[model samples]
Target chain A: MARVELNGVRKTYPNGFQAIHGIDVNIADGEFIVLVGPSGCGKSTLLRMVAGLETVTDGEISIGERVVNQLEPADRDIAMVFQNYALYPHMTVYNNMAYGLRNRGTPKDEIEKRVRKAADILELSEDQLARKPRQLSGGQRQRVAMGRAIVREPEVFLFDEPLSNLDAKLRVQMRLEIKRLQRSLGTTSIYVTHDQVEAMTMADRLVVMNGGRAEQIGTPMEVYERPATVFVAGFIGSPAMNFLEGRAEGGKVVVNGAAGLAAPADIPDGPVLVGLRPEHLAVVDGGAAMLELAAEAVEPLGADTLVHGRLGDGQLVTIRLSGTPTFGEGDRIALAAEAANLHFFDPETGRRI
Target chain B: MVENRPFATFVSHFVLILGVAIVAFPIWITFVAATHDGVRITQVPLPLLPGDQLFANLESAFFTGVGNAREQSVGMMLFNSLVMALMIAGGKIAISLLSAFAIVYFRFPFRMGFFWMIFITLMLPVEVRILPTFAVVANLGMLNSYWGLSIPLIASATATFMFRQVFLTVPDELLEAARIDGAGPLKFFRDILLPLSRTNIAALFVILFIYGWNQYLWPLLVTTDKSMYTVVMGIKQMLEAAEESPEWHLIMLTTLLAMLPPVLVVVVMQKMFVKGLTETEK
Candidate 1:
């Protein structure tokens, strides 16, 4: 139950390699904030700093009101669940959950009461509690890991790609479990993950990071609907937002060898990139003006479909369709996105125009 | 293989018999001799089977009245040997574990220097510096005591090296997880590191037990009193008793007695030793 804040935190290795650039963000108490990005994006490093597992080379990290820059992890009053679930392989599930409490000298009966309560919430039976970690399934081990964190009733919870190690089904299941657990506990949680769906579904607010800098921080829908930067737009969505080279002039954007389209208000006219979400690709509904392209690949996933194709200037792009289109590879198609759905970016700066 | 198993079995037995003889014949010699009359047992065609003089010799081992020299019983000598080996083994293993725990888990100044100290010890055997070591120990006022016998010999640089290597295999996530759970350095060491290293401890135990049991020159140098003699010293004494004409049977029997503790420790902890060695490679 604490707000976590990072004030211009920076981390640099001894050999002069800086991994986390100075970044600042504040997590309000009881908010589930996710740091999402691709591999090597430094999201995990930032999370580890908050967890007090990694040292901050510059600035400060404070849990609630206390600046914990020099505090040990134990003194930080935070609990973290790692991607691998780092269960004590030698201990029974009960002992694994009770270890931190026992370390704090919690009375045996009280420890048992809290451990049993956590186990009940996680749906771990007495029989399961008696079993060692290696005997349990992957999901069970993860729950035991959560149970360990939950019993602490920590001020803040840090998850470093906690569900990344689980299979697809279990990842999804645990995703819901973590969201529910956070909601019930009402503790400030900072989760790091590479998967966008997990971020979108699980984050109360999503902080998308790139190359050691946070690109944007917003509610999940806000990031999805109005990505602050081209990178955020390209990274936040799957079959990511496609970009095509273009130029803006006189309130209008012109594609190379293509029709003129009116630019959004506030677009600067030197050089621009047209950002298009695949789902916005309006396939010719028989009456609308269209841009024709030849489909290169058709991936039908039953509910929706993705059409990967090339435009007139041989610019490669992906088109997402609502219904399975009767389209085949090498077939010609006409598609157009609505003017409102078009996202324009300044070409030179790669920032939203 | 099962249908003609007897023919296959005979082939197996043939190889197995050769292996067993190669591995066990020396042991057979030791055991057979440990149970015989000191004079008759060393004849050219040594007895293929054990002799019946075991009880009398055993009695004589206990009865200093039977042997020409006044000495403590071989039983008392073995007890002394146990105390020596256990002290050395326990001291070295415990110290190595704590030091390894520090080196492997904690980050501090001169970490590499501490590691190099152990590595240097492993690289240089004490035999090269025996006289200086004796001088040091004697100057420390530890002469004629277990501390004198145990201190120089308990460096256990090799065991510490092995433990550090084994400790390197533990996942970083485990340590991070423990840290996040509010376990500090001491609790982490006691609760997680120590428990997970059961196999390594057993492995180190066997290795140190053998090392301590077989220790000779240091113990021989420090322990001057006949009562303070370890089993190995007693065995060497039996060999030197007659000087020019040594008691080979007594020497062999005493040597066999000297080897028993280590052999038993190994047999009991063999599984852990193998696991400890192989798991580290993994």
Candidate 2:
């Protein structure tokens, strides 16, 4: 219902270990922002700070129009679904969803109506609503957790890896359900997960975090296509973006004392890291070759063949090709990439050049 | 179970039966002695079989106590013991639960210092500090009251430690969820924590009830008036009177009554007690 803004927010433990650096992100109303990172990257900490579950050490967080740094989580008008379903094991599903409203002193009829409505939206049957959380399957328990959040009807929803506990097939189904529910409800939401695929599929805009800092924030495609830093470029894609140590000379990248591959024209002549996504590299004949790789291993995944090997300079490289590839181990192959698909980064700093 | 040798199983059953008989021997002897008249009970070798005086002895023990203690009914002493046991068990659970909740959930100054202080009480049992505790009770004018009988015994370190362990095992996310649900500290305790620790509470109640009922030194030291005597202490008084005139049938009957309530409690709540002792949660 309202936008959320974090201005230079940070979190430092009492023992002098800083978990989150100053982070600023402005989420539009009804936008779904997924905070994606590896473990210890502070994604969950940042989300908790927004939920008023953790103290903001340095900056202001405003949900709607009020600065919520000092507000209790309930007073912040937000609901969170934890990684574990966190359903009250003693209470029935109906009571679990209605707990927040009942605590807020909502009338009996209204609490019942809202709980029933949430259960209906979640596709939970009446028979299931009377059962306890332990009686439900993992997926059903997850939906009840969501129903607990939905019945609150708060200004925003916060999901902390809610689907991570589910089985793989159930995770996909719940992911789609969450996406559809968020779209239908149009509630401003912030979801935190370590799965980049979930971030790519579900986020209106994705924030890639690293080392307690927001490394990049953009739409999934925008971040995937033009990652702002070497970290993002390496982190976003499957098989990860391949990097080669080389020096840029006159619009060409010379690697291992060889000058054959062309660099982006804007990259100046200096020591640089050449970045190429695995999918961007194509197996080609000798006429238009970017680099030659000595194939050390091959993984044929039916949909795409992943070739992992070493280049001439002994740097590891991976190349992805469509369909099944007939390449074997220890095969010397030439690969090519379009000039526009190449990324250049300064060797001194990890920032994009 | 893995080998399922019939000879080993027979040996195990025989040993278990022997242990049960050894433990149950006193109760069997008490029942047999209660079935005899006073002269028959005092015979050279007491009768092992039942006599028709069981109901007569029980009625006399229930309506009028043994020997010099006849002024106060044994029934009244049993009632006093029940009240003391219930109060001690209830009071300990309530105090320990609140203190454990405060210690685990809230951070304050000297928190660990206070927790250690409570834990130190475990070493100084009632028998160790009986004189000072009696002085305090007398100063508080609680000397001949049920409060005198139970209150000094209610501040339990073992119960607090057990509850603290149970609370610590509760998931942190449950607290966070309750906070988001707009539940304050007390509501969360009442709604979530109390129910979650129900089995633990029941199990502790069984143990503490027996402890309060079996208290001999503290009750004897505090209650000089015969009317305020608990059943366990009353049994000792009856034995003292038996030195003058042996009322063995009535004394044995009173002993049986004193032990019945706690035994019944354990027997009735055996399942919950075992579950509480073994498992914390689902």
Candidate 3:
């Protein structure tokens, strides 16, 4: 396994379109780093640069002790699993797994042993290994793809939304399987996906990207709990963190012309964007309520109820409370969160306070 | 179609039967004419039923050959035709496949320019450039050779375009995956691209084999030697002798023998041909 480093890597298309502005990431050996973003966010481009599939255009990428910017993908000692599986359709599963070894001129017996071992690890039966990719089910094909990557035993593994083609149930199962496999193999891996849940669950550290730049890169919880920018706070969590326009003065914030909301301590006397996570809020007693919400809709999930409503200041917010909620649509509820759960951002720069 | 109207069904069956009769009548005449002696064939109100000269005509055509083209046996002419067809089909596929691979995969300078240049040759067929091609073949001393017969006809733009379409449909990820699998450009073409185009190649082979087999004018222009005469040209030579004594039975027999190899090719690879034209397997 090798640690990978991307030092100010950039990708610029020939037509003057800049897909990746500049990204610098230092990935530790055996660490699973996930590049997560929306479409056109340059996450996939960054992953392809690391895979040596796309030219770096600028900056240096090194695997182990050698700079790999000039290396071909095969010489870079990396294996990739594409979103579509990209299995060789004409070859049997065994040949698909053994193709790389054969191309590298590995001995026939050694190639067979490695392919058989990979198939065994992937739970593919002997008969299944002899069958072509089209003859296998979607999940089985996915396993064969993984087997193809595993048999190579490359220094690093690259997964480009490998599970996105599977059904929802299979996606979750494969997600767990991939995480477990990566942990056991301890290969430095870079995974790219548009799904935040996959990033949150599968990554040892997450690099949240936006507009071709790395907005925040940290452990999942660190990025979630203490977002560095307004975009990170909005993108990382489910039900998304809610934002409200408010004025900070003295030691408190004023919203809807009412000056009673508790603000974080390190605030200047200026306008600030207040962020409150949906799960951090609770239904408080009427007299103890810091914000009053007019419930517009309620989604009753089994373990939690989400109340999407407008606050007194006319800003939309969502509140997640444990168990079933007594409030329904059109019900006015009092909501409050601890001072530490609140997030403050500078309105002008979108930087966290 | 789902309604299953009786009048529509009857009309459709009648039209289909009429079409079959129109196509099959000439072949039936040829078969019947081959079964009779030349005197019986030349008789007015020609016999539609079989005569007992079938084996006699077969033996005469296979051993002695047709009248005007009798210098070389009909069997030898068939062999020459088979060689030309196979070479033309094989050579066209090889050249077209390589050209399509280069056009689709590589990003060289003037790539599309090269493709359009090849494609433009489709408008300039052999007949249009026959004199120049003949001069080149004569200058190279390839006249009276199998290479002279097939080489000028082997550069097929249609097959190249078809293979190009086939290669374009292949997902880009497969190329990327192969690159990561340590395959170089030519290795990927051999191991991945060629195998994937198997059915398409089969389909094109059937068509090109028939085209080469039916070629009459090009071989006539190139080969002055009787040994290099293809079967299609053999039939034409026999017809030219009809101005004197028309060996109708032997000529009909030669036509029947000339149809066999192409028909066998189509029948043998019918499944692959259909699949290649209709479906693209990944």
lDDT of 2 by residue, B35-69 (tens): 99998999888787889998888788878778767
Task: Residues B12-81, candidate 1: write the lDDT tens digits.
Answer: 8999999999989998987788677866775778877888877776666666511322366788788877
Pairs of residues at least 3 apart in sequence or in different chains that clash in candidate 2: none
| lDDT (Cα) of model 1 | 0.84
Highest DockQ among the candidates is held by which one?
A: 3
TM-score of candidate 2 on Cα atoms, chains taken together: 0.97
Q: Which model is ahead, 1 or 3, in terms of lDDT? A: 3
Q: Write candidate 2's Cα lDDT for A63-101 as tens digits.
A: 998899999999999999999988888788998898899
Tens-digit lDDT track of model 3 for B97-169: 9999999999999999999999999999999999999999999999999999999999999999999999999
Clashing pairs in 3: none
RMSD (Cα, Å) for all candidates, in order, is: 2.6, 1.7, 1.7
Q: Looking at model 2, give its docking quality level.
A: medium
TM-score of 3: 0.97
Give the runs in model 3 whose Cα sits over 4 Å from its true position: B1-11, B242-244, B275-280
Candidate 3, A243-320: lDDT as tens digits: 989899986887767645777676899998989999999998998787889999999999988899998768999989
Question: Which sequence of candidate numbers ranks them by lDDT, best first?
Answer: 3, 2, 1
Q: Model 1 chain A — which ten-residue stretch has the worst lDDT?
A: A284-293
